[model samples]
Target: MRLRKVMLVFKKDWLEIKRNHEVILPMIIIPLILSIGFPLVFIVGITMVPESASSMEDLENMIRNLPEHERNALSQMTPLQASIYLFTLYFLAPLFLIIPVMVSSVIAADSFAGEKERKTIEALLATPISDSELLLGKVMVSFVPSFMITVISFIAYSILVNILSFTMLGRFLFPNLLWIMLIFCLSPAMAFASICLTVIISAKVKGFREAQQISGMLLLPIIALMLGQIAGIIMLGPVIIGVLTLSIILIDYAVLSLSVRAFKREEILQKLI
Candidate 1:
């Protein structure tokens, strides 16, 4: 592989990305709402609600309906706090997974489709880089930003969660095993999966919005996880998160293989109608 040549390709693309705020800013703005805004609202609002109110009374009834084994799980917290804390936290957890996946999809969709929209796709295809190398470069551009944003977002979220825990709960309540797996494992795999899939879609797609709309389907699993937790059908925990990470990794491997195998320059140039 020609490091200098690949670096040149990456550099030119980076400069192009820097100038294209129309394509870039939406990616960051969406993540802001998903990661920062929602967490702040949920944390502060929950702490402000009266613990002994009718809301808690209703929550207690629902808790009683849970299996004794599941109910035993929350023996760590007072009923009032559990109603506000664990109950809501369970529903909020999947947002972490979903946000990163969506961000990756946006970036990947833009990397290829944006080039096409700018009328630069044919020129980029004319570079000295082989098809595999060019594809690898595109993958790097998408994968790096997605994974980096996830890390930064996690840091921002941790600080916010700790602050809310101290100011509202009078202690730290975030950063448990479930979060550890969600942050370090499942989340990155999801990003990779989204990036790979979107790169292919974006290469074939002429419109960024179309690629983005189709790529948004990557959020389905996270959405389902959120709903399941809200309905009390499942709980977010280290064990469940571990299983989820493993399942995603397996799926990622299969999807990534398809991505690499399906990436054909001739086919891409001909366009997939």
Candidate 2:
């Protein structure tokens, strides 16, 4: 339970993460695409398309279902302007969640499972760290980088969105309360949950790739959220984001607690044998 021992494990894993191209590539590429590529395409496409295009119908319908205040705000803009504003700020919001979950899952998948793959599990378990110290260290390894990546992605996305939309909207269009809550609150919770789940799966599985594949399923809920907002079935306003944040935090606590109880150095060593 000592912080010094926990950090020793954290430092060791951080070093491994830096050298693993499989882990580093996605961590870098995915955020770039989500922050830069996606927004650029959406903003340019929306700006070019005429208001009378049939594709505007779906966006219009989605906006109509928004709350009165939000609907009123969008109503002030031309269809093109509204489309760019809404899509960038809201419709694509859930995609940001993917960065954290994916980053954490990839690293957590490598935690113990990668040790087994590389034949290093015995050496790691032989260290003097207690089970709780080891578990917390692994959790921090995943959570720290994932959360940092999520924040940086959010900043990049926010800047790009403001720059892209500035000509049409005549104002900066990001860093609003909803997004603030999303990155600072819900994002960490989701990332922690993904890390814990992936850690558990990583320990139980036989290899890093297997653990990663299973952890990838964690994206289903985030994907569903994106679709729900687009379909007008749900909206990620302040209240909703707050609720989801609390729910995910509770889930994270429960999963982490379970991981601590169930994780055993000898059990993992036995699996390696």
Candidate 3:
């Protein structure tokens, strides 16, 4: 519907989100840990170990199992440099996917369930906004913040990664094609899918916590991606990222269409009674 009405609902929900510690804490903490803490720990640990440690067998195996082009790229680096590169780029990549889905689900879980919990659903529904306007507004609110957080975390991770590995690699090792496609393309699609699904869950559920718990199951796929890479079942190259991005976008379209059809303000109000 109208952009003005959509923005009004967006502003109102965003303001409430700011004061909500339950929502704000995860949004801030999770990104920090994924972007900075994990990288710092892994890189520092890699630096401390002597280059000759045979414990690197697992790492070597993982690298050896990578796709031909990837293997060729790492073939140039010394063992230490290659180890750092593998961990930072390939291993840690899926973890970044978690950030957007997690962030969006948390906020979208609060979209309507939080209203029901706080006994504010009636007031929200009483507003003059149409169903489409309301739905789009909530979707935007969740999508915008989650996407921004993912981008900012990517930037921070990129800088930290480049800086920490600079001594060993003698170059900036961040912002490669795979990562760029992963962040800019796949991340938003994933976030939108998570938000729309969570919004639907939020409408049906009784409380914010219940909605959040259900939405948390969305992490399963991302975890599978991470494990797949470790087991050498799959690798996230530029082509794979592009494919996943398009797939998720299509999923988002279907879920969003379903969400619009299912989200009836009158139905939600009836439940509140």
Candidate 4:
């Protein structure tokens, strides 16, 4: 693919995103709430609650079930400290995956589907861009922004978590290897997968709402992972992280290959008719 053509499409899509509040608003607002708002509330609430003996005991029992090294780390802290550590560090990890999934799906949902809404698909299809060039450009629109937002959100979350826990723990406890892997590896893979799925849906769906609704189904896995972690059934270790990243990468390749074939200019023009 020609870099010039891909950049041109990227630039055009970026400009359109800026003008279309429907597409851009949720992209920014959702991440802000997840990354900053929820953490702020959790940190503040934990700081205010006084440590009780019963609560401490329950927390201790839960931590004891964790792996040896993990249990040892939390065992050193007071009950309140342990509770905060559990929620901010461990519980929030899986839930963080939702950021990239949601952001990419939102943008990709708007791609061809939104163009259809605006009656612009024919003009877009008439352009001289090759099929691969077009697909790559559209994929990047969602993939790039979603990955960047995930990184930024992770940074914001890590800073907030450490700052809030520092008073109790007396040290920075975030950006650990697990978190680093999640952000740099697993998170981008998740975003890419979402982009490919949503792009495929957008090509066939007639409206942005329909495309978005279908793409939203991708969240089911992330939600399941979050629930599993809460129930102590799943853990985010290096091995699990590696497996998830590989799975997502394979799915992304498969979905993207199919999406490119399905994104035929003639099919899009026919839909526009």
Give all candidates' CA lDDT scores.
0.71, 0.86, 0.88, 0.83
The residue-level lDDT of candidate 2 at 67 comes to 76
List, residue by residue over 4-78, the lDDT tens digit for candidate 4. 898888889999888888878888998999888987787677667654322656654446446789888876877
Clashing pairs in 3: none
Instruction: Flag the better candidate by TM-score, 1 or 2.
Output: 2
- Which residue segments of model 2 deviate by more than 4 Å? 51-56
TM-score for each candidate, following the candidate numbering:
0.84, 0.95, 0.94, 0.93
Model 4 residue runs over 4 Å out of place are: 51-65
What count of clashes does model 2 give?
Answer: 0
Q: On TM-score, who's better, 2 or 4? A: 2
| Higher-scoring candidate on TM-score, 3 or 4 | 3
Residue 56 in candidate 2, Cα distance off native in Å = 5.6
- Candidate 1 lDDT over 1-273, as tens digits, reads 666665666677667676778646866876788778876675566557655323534555446545575467556656546654554355566777876777777667887788777777777777667766776677767776767777777777777767765764687756766677888888888787777888888878877888899998878877887777766567777777788789878888887788877877667656733
By lDDT, the better pick of 1 and 4 is: 4
Q: In candidate 3, residue 117 scores what lDDT?
A: 91
lDDT for 14 in candidate 3 is 98
Candidate 3: list runs displaced more than 4 Å: 51-57, 64-69
Provide the lDDT at 220 for model 1: 86
> Largest lDDT belongs to which candidate?
3
Where is model 2 poorest over a 10-residue stretch in terms of lDDT? 49-58
